[model samples]
Every structure is written in structure tokens, then in C-alpha cells.
Target: MRFKSIVLVSHVTDLSGPSEAVENYLKTRSDRLGVIYHPFHYCADRRSRMQDYRGGTLLREARQGGWNLPALATYVKDALFTLFYFLRLGGRYDVYLGADPLNTVVGVVLKWLGLTNFVIFYTIDWMPERFSNKLLNAVYHWLDRFCVRHCDAAWNISPRIQDVRRSQGLPDAKNVLVPVGVDLEKIDLPDKSASEPRDLVLLGALAPSKGVDLVIDAFPRLKERFPQLRLHVIGKTPHDAVEDGVVYQPYEPRLAALGEGVILHGAKPHDEVLAMLPAYDVALALYKPSPNNLSQWADPSRVKDYLACGLPTIITPVPEIHKDIAALNAGIVVDYAVEPLADAIGRMLADPGQWRSMREAALAYMRSYSWSSILDRVFEESFRAKA
Candidate 1:
């Protein structure tokens, strides 16, 4: 895996989103000279800087508007800034691993400028429909297609996205399936908090599109069935705005005639969240399909976190993510409807043997998704190409 240099780039500098994967990937090759371009702070609630690209430099921008910009404007600015920084700061390298579409677009520009030998596009999720306005969606679609056309190789996270790119005229040879990876060391994590087992948990942003309401709705019925069932909601939110059974829904209507037994632990450190995964029976990741979820191959990192902890996941049909879970029988896949979700919960709770098997299967699946192997393959494929 020798090279002149290898760099990874992303639009966001926070440790929360795709940058988390970049950090974990760097851990596998700490000795290598790897640069990372992540200039802006996207998380205001926490000041979590991404891990420095040790043995190399971190290219950053001088201008940033922080996290308060309008959604469409934010992405537009991100793409523009990524191009600006990469053009100015990117040095000669063998590969520039892009952690997002916009950054991959920058990689394309870098390749055209001869700053890098190869541009590898690494994306966990994408869909043009994410933008609400028609014109904005058109701009996103055009920029994404530009990325698809120019990158030397693509590390697509979802099989569904592979299909999407194929339909959009990407050749089969240009794309490879590279699912998200987890730190294998997180498998048997020591507890950071002495918390009792929560029967159910959802640990991510509690935004409307995340399907938080469905989990809260399922809780009342789930508690009735299991008696000791309690739902743990952990992640970022707008305010201290949650009650036991009565949850807030700013984007959609509240789940009426739903259940209770909700406990809001709010947000915790990333390490703390992973540490607390062992104290939960099931990890809930209910991302509703289509418009609710903006990804063609929806990235459910929360699902990966659950599997890394050996917890059986209960997920909605989240595109390719659901298929992976269902194929391995790693967990249950239920409809977003409260009744079906509640039924799945009851089924898991009623059958301990099945639960154990699913937990085992989840661990087995994790064994195959090591970041070390994934990164090696990414580098190998990127450099060993015909170009």
C-alpha cells in the first residue's frame, strides 16, 4: 500500500457524519502519509474535531458559515469551498479519497489539474431528491453526474447506489461495492456508563426523517407486551422537548394513541454511545423509505453501530441496508407502521433463542466489515487500475 501520498477529503470537519469513517480508516494506517481536507465545523452542539491525518497535513479553508446556513445554500457553498481548498492546498498524491459527493467532485477537479494521480469517490448514501426545490435538485444531479463521470474509481456503499449509478450511465468497471466499516476494537467495548439494559434504543439525530416518531409510537405497545420494556432515545435534538409517551414531531404529526415508557438520555459522546450499546437489548433504526429518506442506498450507520455491539437491530426497509440485515437474519425488518413494529418487538422479546441467534449473526456480519481490509482494498483497486 505504498504511495507518494494518499489524501481523503470531505466538506464537513466534524466527527459526526462520514468524517467518522475517515477517522476510523486512518487508524488502520497511522504510519502512512495521509492528508485530509475538512475545513468547516458542522456540529455546533459539540466541538469534535476530526482526527488529524497523522504523518501528513490537514488542509483547511479560511472561510466558513458554520451550521446556520439554509439547506440548499449550505450544500452549494460546500461544493464551491471544497473545490477552492483542494485546488489550492491539494498536493501531488496517488489517490484522493473523497468522503462525500461534493468532495469527490473536488477530487475530479484535482485529477484534471494533475494534482492527484487517481480520484476515488467514496459515498455512503446519495439521492437527488434530497433537495426540496426542483432547480436545486437539478444542480445537485448535474454535479453528482459530473462526479460520476470524472472520478477514476468509485467506492459505493450501497448496492442500490451501484444500480443508481449504472442507470445514470456509470460503467460497471468504474464502481465497486464498499459498505461502511466499523472499528473492530469496538466489538467488546468496556462500559463507559453503568446503565441498566434498555429494552430498546435509538441513538442518532432525532430529526423527523429519522423515523423517531415510529419508535416512540411502538414503545407504548412494546411496554405493554414486555412489561419491563423501556425505550432509550439518545442523540441530538432541538430542545429538552420529550415526554414519557408524548413525543414532539415538528415535521410530522405526533403519533396518536401510541405508547409510552420513553426515557430521553439526550446526546452523549460518540465513545460513550458505543460503550452504552451493550446495555441495550435491541437497537432501533427506523428510516422510512423514499421521500422520508434522501438516499437511494440509505446509510444506516446506527445499524452498523448496533451490529458492532452485537445487538440485534430492528429496522425499517432502508433500501440496501435492510437487504443486508435480512439476508444474514442479523435482525428483524418491520414496516414503519406502529402495529407491525410493535409486533416485531414482541416477536423478538418472546423468542430469546432467536434473539441470541440474531445477535450472533450480527456479530458474524461485523467480522466481515473491518476498516483495515476495506481501506486496503480501496487503495489496491484505486492504484491497480488500467489508467
Candidate 2:
């Protein structure tokens, strides 16, 4: 039987990945689906917001910082607000998909209360130590395991998460791989013979674990070899010094030192990022090695976007997608180091024939990851009748 009515709950920091994909897909069924989003704004000037959508239309959207509290407090407040908002809507839905653990736990509670039929725990990122605080970290994992064992199904963004879960001996949650997908319809392939000094791009937040510093350190040597080569670093950096499993630092000065060789375009809209990917010859996803690095358990959406736009990527073996990319010859997988990353970029730029061939492979591989097809498979597997 097909699910007639659904609602998706997710925390929004940016317009990216699985959340955006799922929301867009559900909107097509606007007659029956709903969406609840809690957007967290880092800048004090930008207030937190809550958005509610139903029957394919936005029912309410509110923005205010009346309760401008600390990060932990904000999160707790958001969870309560989500519960109240669903209750306000009569609290009934056929399917409820929540992105992060906290959001999914809310759904599980609603299910326990007989307000929702099927609850999906959509695992986006899993780090060994999710929070720096010992008590909070323990609480986070307890909630995660609780959701997995209790939810109707656990939708892991990567297969590795399933493996990780089993290793932890968590009770069998009906696990499904709902990997990150690309918007194929919007992305046009870059011109194969576009002459260069070709450029490289790295998308998403410029975090320490994201390997932005490694990229910066390697840029000078790369620029010396190919005088006209440019590196486009997209997305924002930490607004303040904070610790949440990973340390945050200000890297604006370091980026500024590179001048014309490195172009920093901070946090563009997701659609704009898609539009800009095709112009670059190579994409970078060099995640640094750390036991707590979240990328290790993620199926990164940026890599998918790069492949969809027909740009061969230079990635570290941190994400689950890297294995497929390496196997398909769609991209180069290197250690999370400056030299390997720089060399990988050089190889892609110096050899026109190899880059073109890899670009073809990337496009071919990405066809399987279109949002429509991926979500269709997810629902089919999720809601399939058992005899």
C-alpha cells in the first residue's frame, strides 16, 4: 500500500543535500505531504526560523530570536516547538521522516503516542563523538540507538552507517541505504573542450575536518606549477570560536593570503552552487582524518553534484561514495594530505583526455543517483507489503 500522507522534519543550516531533495520530491505530492523545518542561524543578526508546510502549501513561517539562548538550549527548545507544532495540526501522518537523531526521536515519541503510522530515522552524519561534552555525547548516541531500534525503518545516507551500526551490536533496525542524490535535471554538463587554465572547486562549509587548510597550503605549489590555475572555495566558515566534537577556527586571513590564485565565494544558494559546478574542471572533497570526523559516515552530496555536472572529483577516502567513485574511475581518491590532493588536481588538469573520460564516467555513475529515482526506491522498499 502506498503512503497517502507524509511529513518530513529536519534541522536546516543550509539548503543542501537529502533534506532539500526529499522536500522537493514530497512537494510534488503536496495534496498529502507536509514539512517542518527548524533553521539554525549562526549569525546573531539572523534570527532562527520555523517553517511549516502542508498539502503542498506553506501553512506558517515564523522568524524571531525572542529566546536567543545557547546552542544546546536552542536545540532543546526547537524539539519542544516541533512537538507542539505537530500537535497543533492534530498530529497524524502516514509517514514521518526525520533527518537527524533528535528530530527522528521526536517522531518516535509521536509514534508512541499513536500520532504517526511509520517513522523513519534518516541518519545523515554519524561521528564516534558527536558532541564534545561527555554526557551530551553519551545522550546523543543513546538517542540514536533508541531511534534506530524503535523507528519503523532507519534510512542511512550511506551503507557504511549500516555496517557501523551492526558493529556496535545495536538491535536490528530495518536499515535502508538512502544515499545523497544530485539534481540531474538542473545540471548541464560542462563543455568537454573548454580551454584552460582550468579551475578547481570545493563546496560546503570550510571546516577544519573538511580539509580547507590542506587545500590552502597546497595551493601555492599548484599555482607555481600552473600559473593560471585557480581554486574556488565556496561556502562559509565558523562565525565564532566554538567546540562541538571538532574545533572551529577563523580561516579568513589564510584564504586572503592566496589572493588571485584562490577565489573565496562564501556560501551561495544551493541552486547557485549547482549552476556554478559545471564551469570548474575538478572538484575537491578532501576530508581530514579524525576518529570524530562526521564525513567518514556520510554520503556527501557535493561529490554527487560534482559528478552530475560532469566534473571529475579529487576526494579523500572519508565518505562511502569514494569507493564507488574510485571503482567507476569517475574520480581520484587520495589520502587527506596536501601533496596527494595537489597532485590529484594536477593530473586532472594536465591530462585533457583523462579528464574527459573520467567526466563521462562521473555522468554515467550519477544517473543512478537522481533524486526522483532514489526516493522512489526508498519508498518502494520502505512501504512494500509483506505477505
Candidate 3:
């Protein structure tokens, strides 16, 4: 009812994370809902790429970015080529949405060319500090400012990110709080709970930023309290760069010393993880505070997933969900240290009554973070651009 269609642009090669969320939302709306959709992304293989999206197109120059300088060149080419692709579309879509700066640049240029009525730049996980050099960080900072200045609206995943934009001299009115929300169907809680549960799960990539080592280090104390508390690292290994970190350098060997309590289940399918979550008593998303965390840029999904499975969560300050975890009695949000983490989990497990109450609260809180509630606001704002 708002716009003719919405075009989402991202340079990400995978449709697994955020892209998968978008696709799930698309399935709910009908062709007559006037919610026609389009997606723009990178694909190294044209034949295999864009197969998931009916209206999506491949960025011909798009190659996965690497640590080398060619990665920088490949990104620049992707952004420049996206501009050409936009023009080639003859402005078919009414609203333009982009995930990162380069994609935002393409949307901004589309708006300038009168190809779209509104330019919505969705700021998800951003980490200028993750860059290897100062020059690249500085360049990304400038590009971020450019997007903030040019876009008609900002769809930010975290409220904290708005402060980052305002510091760049943008107004609060320009930024809309749009959480990277969860799909209700996919994240449904299993009917039955763990009968005699004493397991904890830390989901997501095993990265330095993710604080996998912090969890491991904190576990010696957690294990002392709950001897039956098995910790599951349920995700893939960190990026190649981070795998070389002191903590992750041959993580298996380092993890082996932690003993039989810790289980490293590398990267499971989405459905399997959801189903497996209720088997654990506590879910962990304890990211160590860093310039590279999703805390400021996006709402971390692991927390949402854990809650949807009706498991109380243990998290650090690095996730945007910490406040909710604290306020709603959902779970523990403790300092990123060994003693504090151990104390929190110890307190949580010591009281079976409190843990049961928090488990219920976790599901209730997760209801608010569903995508069904957020997508309407996203489209409502996009449609209002002309008004």
C-alpha cells in the first residue's frame, strides 16, 4: 500500500544471516499485498547466484573480500558497478534500502537520479576498527558520514548507533530504530523443555570479538559451581584473520585443555540450532566489548534465537539486548570478566525458581523482538517519504 516495491541492497555474498531474515519476511506477504521486492547482492558465480531471489541481480564485479589489497579494489568495483545496475533498472522500484555504506551510496545515487522516492540506509553490524589499517577506517568513516547526510531516512539496528550518527552531525529525526528482528515461525519455542538441564550454549562465530575465549576462561569457575553444566560452542570458527588471534590460534588445542565439559559443535543449520536450543538450560551470547562488536551497529540474533526457544540467556554488555535482559528478568547481563560471569551463572542456577521464572520471561521479551511487528514500520516510513 505504501510503495510500488522495495529494493534491498547489500554486497554480502551469503543469504544465510540477515539476508535469510529478509527472505523469510518476504514469504509472509502476498503478491497482491503490494509488497513487491527486489534484492541486490554480490555473486562470484552468476549461474548459482541470485537464484534465491526472484527480483535480485548479481553485481558482476563482485568477489568475496579478502585480507589483501585486491579486496579493496573489488569492493570499489562492486559499488561503482551497482550504480550502473541501478540505472539499468530504469528506476522500477519505488523505495531503495541498503545495508552498508557502499550499498547506501548506490541507493543515494538512485535517489539523486529520481529512481526512488526514498533512500533508507539500514546500518547493521559496522566496525571501522575491524579494518587492518587506519586509512581504510578513515575512508569508511567518511563514507558513513556521506550516507548519513544523503539518505532520507536511517534504519538503524541499535539505538546506540544513532548516537554515532548524531556525532557525525545528523539529527535524531533522520534515524529510525529498526532492530534486526527475528522471524516468529522460524524461532518458535519447542513445546517441551529440558527435563534435567544443566547445559549452556554460546552461539555465533568463534571470534575474538565474540568473546569465545572469554567464555572459555570464565568457564573454569562456572564449571566449579555447576559440574553438570556442559558448555556448547554452537557455531562456525572465526574469520581467517581472527583465527590467528592468541585465543583462537589453533582453538581446538586450546579448547582441549578446557576438558570434557566444553563441546565445540561447529556451524549447524538454522533449524537444527533452534530445535537444539531448548535442550540447554542457558544460552550464551557473551561478546567482549570491542570496537568491532555488533553492540552499537546491530541487534545480535543469538540472544533472540535463545529466547525464542524459551531458554534464559547469559550475555555481556556488547549486545543491544542487555538492557532487556536486565529489566525483564530474562537472564543475566554481567561484566565481561571471569568472576562476574561465574557469579551470575552461579546465582541463576542456584535458584531453580528464579531460572523457571526467567525462562518464561525470556519468551515474553522475545515476542517484542519479532520481525512481524517491525516490517510494517519499515514500509510505513518508506511510503511516507513522498508525503
lDDT of 3 by residue, 1-387 (tens): 232466666644322455556645653442211111222222222211121223332223222223233546656756655555554444456667777787788788767777776777878767657465678778877888899889888877777776777777776667677776666676545544435457888887656766667777878877786788888777765334342224446455566688979888866767678767777788877777766554646787777888878888888877677888889999988878777877777877788778888999988887777776787776566446534
Per-residue lDDT of candidate 1, residues 1-387 (tens digit): 544456666654223555566555564454433434444423543211222343444433244434456556566666665555444443555667886666787777777878777787776667757456678768767877888888888777788778888997877777777777776775564442323334788777666556776776667666666777777777755443433224665422332234355666666766777777767788888776655365436565667888888788888886566777999999988887888888888888887778878877888888877766776786676555535
Superposed model 2: Cα runs more than 4 Å off:
1-3, 40-48, 64-68, 166-173, 194-197, 241-249, 385-387
Best by TM-score: 2
List, residue by residue over 109-197, the lDDT tens digit for candidate 2: 88888888888888888887887778888988998988877777778887789887677564443667788888788886656765542
User: How many residue pairs of model 3 clash at the backbone?
Assistant: 1
Q: On lDDT, who's better, 1 or 2?
A: 2
lDDT over C-alpha atoms for residue 180 of model 2: 86
How close to the true structure is residue 66 of candidate 1, measured as C-alpha lDDT?
A: 48
lDDT of 2 at 177: 77
Candidate 1: clashing pairs of residues: 220-259, 220-260
Once fitted onto the true fold, the runs of candidate 1 whose alpha carbons sit more than 4 angstroms away are 12-15, 27-52, 56-64, 83-92, 189-198, 238-261
Task: Quote model 3's TM-score.
Answer: 0.81
Which of the two, 2 or 3, has more TM-score?
Answer: 2
Q: Model 3: residues >4 Å from true position, as ranges?
A: 1-3, 11-16, 27-69, 80-91, 126-132, 167-173, 191-196, 220-225, 243-248, 256-261, 292-294
